[model samples]
Target: MAMKHFTIQDAATMYGVKEWGYGFFGINSKGHLEVYPTRDENLSCDIHEVVTHLHKKGIRTPVTLRFPQILATRVTELNEAFHKAMKEYDYEGDYQGVFPVKTNQIKEVVDHIVKAGYKYRYGLEAGSKAELMIALSMNLHAEALVTCNGYKDESFIRIALLALKAGRNVLITVEKMTELPLILKVAKELKVEPLLGLRMKLNAMGSGKWESSAGDHAKFGLNTQEILDTVDTLERRGLLDSVQELHYHIGSQITDIRKIKAAIKEATRVYAKLVKRGVPLKYLNVGGGLGVDYDGSRTTFHSSMNYTMEEYAADVVYTTKDICTQEQVPVPNLLSESGRAIVAYHQVLVVDVIGLIDTTHTKYRVELSGQEPQILKELAYTRDNISVKNFAEMYHDAITQKDELITLFNLGYLGLDDRAKGEILFWEVCRKLSRILSYKSLKYIPEEFQDLNKSLADKLIANFSLFQSMPDHWAIDQLFPVMPIHRLKEKPTLSATLCDITCDSDGKVEKFIDLKDVRDEIPLHEPKSGEPYYLAFFLVGAYQDTLAMRHNLFGSVNEAHVIVNEDEDFRIQQIVPAQTTDDVLKSVHYDPDELVEGPTRRRKISANSDANEALKTALTEQRKLHTYLEMN
Candidate 1:
């Protein structure tokens, strides 16, 4: 039989590359995955070349590739989209975006965003004191605004006041009524007029997994009475001008466009009311909820958004404009803290497959002697009689016979050898049934055999730690696009689940994104004995890096930053190597130097030269080795 052919298009479609890739990632004619820094340019850089380059430089698998060009492009795209919308709608308000530092917080990622967004006068949003410190240290442009959010102590308030005094555009958003008094006291002590904003708890809830971030029962934000009291208190204290911004966060990863429209309309109404009350609300901060289509379904699914960036900008601008016009209030400056949408596409995690555990290796017939157990003979008979027409019935019979054999063995009526033979026969029957089911149409397959493929699929053991790299997948069931980096031109004949190197059983990625639903297995090529196969997880730049944990003492992996030059040639801008064993030990409060010294001291005290030499060699090896598996 002729080998089935698979093209790059097939790989792209199977992995939803066109839907989620945003034209930055695709398969090239060389049968290797490529990254396009600019979609309009004809130049492209092969990812395999980047991996090979890193390997030659002593970096191995389980590495993350960071493309700063993609981050810059996304920032430009977002600013341009809003600018175009404002122009088309003829809105007078200016659009300013703040990168939420909590999304990544990595020094390199934050530095790149600051550099990329300089042209747009982009700002930063800090949720905690540490984040605020990072934001304050950044060399943001003069016109950029730095918004301080989340719960704050006196120190946090003092820091914001200090930043305001430093000639920075700093806004402190009050989450509760009590926070206003603290901010006022801090402002008086510092002798600086603090810029204050209010986070209103809107009744319009968001959509998708993070819907709890908004609505009436949200964890943060004030109610209607609280808002009125806040304004009243500010007026009484004669600090009403301090309240310059009104902010509301519907949620994160909001999938429905209608929910956004509703939230914007309601927030606009509140803004109009405040404007009528003689409050100088100059900034309308629409907190981040912009969604990324991780699965590329383009529906109201949790992993996707139904609206485009253009539509989102238009809706937000037009809704605010229409409401402000009706209320006869000046349109406020627009601010969005969209961190996920800007950073999700810039990083890709690549892992290497170590080996595979095939479960369908018992397809051959199980030899039986005439003196075997009656139940074993019955199972063999069912396995032999399984045809395309009677595969389902034979499968049922085999299962029944196997169960009986197990019960007999437990009751001391069947030998261990007989039970083993019966188990083999039962699996052979399932293998034949799976083949027959594959020949039948999807709809015609029996419900009993629907999960046969998943049960029989191979388990591909990969050389990465799921808890250390992609924790959201295990914690919140977040789906990421996964696909093989090479071998796109060859058809994948094996259905497998990716199992990470972590010892915990929860380290396996079994649920994969599909067009209509989640799939149980990912299609992959059969593993070769002496070759390496790599797979990449896409859209992981947003939260994975910061959210990774040290479970099983598996520290962060190696990272490579790639810069695409004007001529489309890729350069290794930076290579952050993975954590060594000694590094991880130090993190957990283990003194590596003391550990080596104590053992060596004891060996020397005993006057054992061989023991001392062995300890020295062991210590040297431990300090140089990484925590992850070093594949041969």
Candidate 2:
């Protein structure tokens, strides 16, 4: 049979790159995975070449690359989407997109977002005190908005009122009834009439793991009756006009558009009713749930979304206009806190495979002596006679004889040598069975028999900390796109899964993204000896950065930022090195000086020059170098 022909398109299709890349990425003629970050075809470079550039600077694999161009493009796309929607529908309400910094708290990310969004009066939404400080510090131009959310103490409320006093376009969203009295007192003390947003708990719950946190009983928002009571309280306090926005959050990463439409309809109706009652609301803040298609299924899958950005914008704008037109109230300005969708695509984590664990590499002939037990003889017979025609019965018999071998060993009927020989023969037989069952003539494959591929898939040991780099995968089983960064024109002859260089058994990735469902293994090319096999984990800019933990003391990885320029030119603008051993120790409150001295004093080495020089060199390198495994 002729070898199956493979092309770059074939590799792209196998990895579903086009399905989820959305024009920011593609395959080049040289079989390299190139990134066209600004959607400009001419301004592109393969990721492998970028990594090679870094490699020349002594930066090893397991690095992160941030494309500011992609980030800017996404912001522009979002703002333009809303603009087109408003123009097409002739909607009266204005649009301003507020990026919730809780999605990604990196300073460079937020700063680039501000610069990119300056045209649209784009703003930042803060969910904590520190994030609020970042929002205020980053967007002090007064045209950019600063939304203060989450539960507030006196200090939090006081800070928001102070921003209002500073002539900032800041809105302090009231999440609970108790927050109203607190906000009023803070405003009274500061003598500043605060711009407020009332967060209403709507009846529309989305479909996902976050469904439990949405709807009327959500942890953050107020009920309908409570909203009315708060409105009445504001009326009594002679501050009804202070309520400038009505906010509602369905959930984060909502998969279904029907739920979004329902939530928008409910939120618009609430805004309309409040407007009729003379609340003077100017902004209807429909909170974030815009999802990224991590799996590219584009269905109601929890990891994917069923709507496009334009569709989401149109639904929000038109639905609000339709509701308010019927209620005879003026349309309010729309603000969406779609943080996940905005920041999820700009960062890519690239890790190099350090080693491969092939189970069949140790395969050999296991000769059986005549004095061996019947179970061992049966296992040897199964191994030498296995084929596709009778693999099922042969596999079954091998399993049976293996179980009996274990029983014989436990019962002292088999010696150590006999048990070892039986174990080796059983695995050899199973390997042959797996190899033959994948033939072209095999029509029907049993489920258990098919699972042999997963069991036998090569293990690619990667050189990055899973807990530190991609925490969402470990915490909630979120799937990111994983594929080889180069060699796309060649066929992937190996089925493999990833294993991070952590001691914990859970530090591995066995499930991969698939069109129909989850896959157990990923197709990958065989790693060449003495060559770095690089793989990238894409779409990880959202919550993974801040949510990462210091599992096994792997603090952070090296990061480089790329800025694409006109005429197909790009430059590495900035590089942030990984944390050093001294830095990691200091972060955990361990003094590096004390640690070094303690080990040296405990060792009590001779006062010789050679011994002292060796210890000093080792200690100096340990304190200065990074925590990851050194390649040089």
Candidate 3:
């Protein structure tokens, strides 16, 4: 039989992977995010080398690279997809999307989004007064919409009205019934009537962690009674004409397609009712629930969505068109605040794999002398005699002996050497027992021993921090697609958990994406000699970068923007260095000037004793390095 040779594309194109490559993302020929590369020639740029270069330049541990080209491609694809759907459905409505600033508020990211979307007039969504200011300041085209959401006070409403006063197309969405009165009061006091939108509390609920964010009893939005009161108040004040848009967010990462149809129908009815009451509504704001398949599963999992982008667009347009036409209402513009879907695929967080623990090291192996200890003999027996039929009984006996050995060693009944031998033998036995049990019965395997798969498991030390860079994963158990940047040709031999360098115990990912369950880590191939190993976390552009916090004073990671130029060459632009120790201290109101003194202040005039001589030499060295003790 002849051997078949396959390139990275060919392997990635196999079976279902090819569809993900097209619909989701792939490295383009210019080393950018695209459907696939232009050709094999485009694979010349090494993502791993980028990490190594950054690490060598003192940008150690974790670093996030923002690819502006990918952001451009994402904005383009989203617009094109919805536009194509409109054409296919014979829809009369125009499609517009806004990048919710809450998803990611990084300056470079927002700048790149605006630049890429200048032709399409893609706008920004704001959930706060500050975010509205940012959106108002950045949106270049007057045709784009500046959407204001979230809880609002007088100042927040006042600023949004001011944005409208400045000729910006601002839509202030009333989240609560109370906000409506405040919004009306602010607009009347300021004498600026801005376009108004209402986020309705629909009866339909989405499925995800944020499912509770909507529905009839949602935290935000107006109920049926509240909606009627709002309409009455508007009619009385002659401001009903300002109610131009109806918005509803079932949830973020809505996995169920049926929920989409239901929510749109519910929201569409609300729009129709408002229209029936003489409130002219011209827009349907389907607030940001278009989910991404984070787990690559076409299932209704919280981390994954069941429907495709085309299906999602079709549902939104078809449902709205049907409801509006049936009610004899004009077709409204379709607006989506799909922050996650828009920005998720636009960025990849590439972090290097520092090192791994070799579980098979000889130092961890057991070598028993004559008259072996009871725990060692039991371990040997467990390793040699434990089978699927007797695994449970042997495991119990081994555990008992293990506890006894540890207790004896702590109480000085056993020697240090014996304790070491006992632990090694017990671990060897546990590994073998786990292997035997996994085949016939894995249910009995303890959670602590679940890492003992037959395949060699390597602990991967990632450069990124869970608390600092990927807080959502640490906080909400959100799973992102992670894979090696290179070495696609090699089969991975090890599966291990990723441990971040944070002092918090919750800073590790124990669950990773697997066939049956979300796992803590994926299998990784061993590194070739002198070659740096790296893995990239995909679909992290939204919310992860800006929402990251500095835990344990670890500081933030360095960031760089990667752009694919018109010549199809990749270039690094706008490198913002990470904060230094002094800089971070200054941020927290620490005055470095007050705590510092010159080296001459610490010098002793009489240095005859040995201690004085040593102190004088230490002071000289510290002065050379520009370091000083705070005590001075």
Candidate 4:
């Protein structure tokens, strides 16, 4: 028998992949992701080997693999697309993009963005003072614009002023009327004039799950009245020329292109008005709201978008230029804060399947003891007689028998021996019945067993911490593409929901992305004999790494950076190992030093011991040494 082979193309199709720009994952002649699992004539790296390598290195259970080249490619593509749009549209404006630090604050991720984006002079957008500090520290390009947003206090304004003093061109966006006064006071105290901007609350609403992020009643930004008031305040302070930018944002993951055009028109009109009122603004900061095609539908749905990156840039530039040109205002430098589009496709999370529980792989067998309970016999009969057509009926009958058996045992009507038989019999029947109803060919599943479907959903024990790898799934119900990375030649036989190694019940990803509701189970292939199976989670690069919390005491996953050079040999740049038991304990304020020393003392005192005691002491010392080595 030949072993079944699966390729990356198989996984891409299962993900409903559509070419948004370039291929993130595609099938090669040998299968698996384009870079990993390269083609070999007879023997090649399979998903099993890829997973086993990491597991052998002590990077098991959960890991996030980040490809720096993919991130660089995504950033390059976005910048090039917008520039191409500018040329195609013949718009007089230029593209100046900034990565929002709030999206993903991982040091390595931010460091790479700053380094790789040097040619494009890609800037950073900060939403808070702490984020502002990071942006200022990382932004080596003096020409790159560091735009500061969010509600500001004296300290926030002071930091922005300090950034300007350091010779970095920092734009401070006033979200409220009072922030203008704070900025004025801080700038004067610091003896440095700050470049100012205002976030306008546009009347045009955006489309998507976060539509309220930019409209009239949005959480942040200034209303029409406040916008006018800020202009007067700046003029009164003799800093009108310092107010060089106007900004607005509808929301993130904005699906509708029309809303973008409307937002541009509205913000442009405000920009023109600011110029007419003697406010010398020279830039327009269209805040972050760029959408990502999470579902790959590409139909203007909330989780998806119809417009391409080029189309988006052309729309913004032309709309702003057309309106400003008509109003006789010069086209300001075009700026956009698009964090999702720049970083979403750069990271992938790889997890391994440890085992699965299946009770229906065997034929019906009856085990009858002299003291066996009567209900156990009935359950055995239910399992033996069940058929696809009568599966539901048989399941109900078995449930009734199971209840009677439980009651009989409680009342001492049955013995322990009978109770054990009844328990096993009932579970086997339930499992088998569930298998029947959940068969793919079953035209319709009865409504009464909907909850039962979830209860009996195939339990695939994957080596991962869902909360640590994909926090958005647990925090905001954000869904990403998930599928097996191999075994295309063989068809899937199990409908499985993945469960992580975490002890918390909520650590499972039972609900997945679907058109109707969160999915119950995804199709999974059976592992070939003496072979292992693994799966990969895609599109996890944006905020997952930085935002992941230490839920259930699980630390960050082991991360590797793969760089594809000219020869196509992926050079593994850096491999940051995951936290050890001691590391996790220290993060929670526990002094692992004391806990670590406990073992050494215990080992020295085998002052009196049998072989078993000596063996236990040696094991304790080995465990402590392992923990120390991993942490270091």
TM-score of each: 0.95, 0.96, 0.86, 0.84
- Tens digits of per-residue lDDT for model 1, 88-181: 9999999999999999999999999999999899999999999999999998999999999999999999998998998999999999888988
Worst 10 residues of 1 by lDDT: 357-366
Best-to-worst ranking by lDDT? 1, 2, 4, 3
Tens digits of per-residue lDDT for model 2, 140-186: 44577899989999999888889889888889999999888999998
TM match of model 2 to true structure = 0.96
lDDT digits (tens) for residues 1-632 of candidate 3? 97565445643532123333334445433323332222223433445555555666655435677666667777887888889888988998898888899988988888888888888888899998889889988956779889998998999888889879978999999888878878888888889886988878888999989988776678888888877888888888888889888888888889999999998887888788778878888889988888887777678888888898789988889999899889888778999988887677766676666667665432477656658767677777776787777777887777888898999888888898888777777767767675686685355665655555522355666666777677889889898767776666654556566766667778776766543466645666675656667777777877887777767655566776655444334557767776554555566686544334333345554445666556556644433231111110
Better of 1 and 4 by lDDT: 1
Residue 311, model 2: Cα distance from true site in angstroms:
1.3
Clashing pairs in 3: 510-520, 511-519, 511-520, 512-519, 512-520
Better of 2 and 3 by lDDT: 2
Alpha carbon lDDT of each predicted model: 0.89, 0.88, 0.72, 0.74
Candidate 3 lowest-lDDT run of ten: 623-632
Tens digit of per-residue lDDT, candidate 4, span 30-65:
444443221122222233334455667665535566
Sorted on TM-score, best first, the list reads 2, 1, 3, 4
The reply for model 1, stretches above 4 Å from the true place, is 1-4, 360-365, 369-371, 411-417, 440-442, 566-568, 597-612
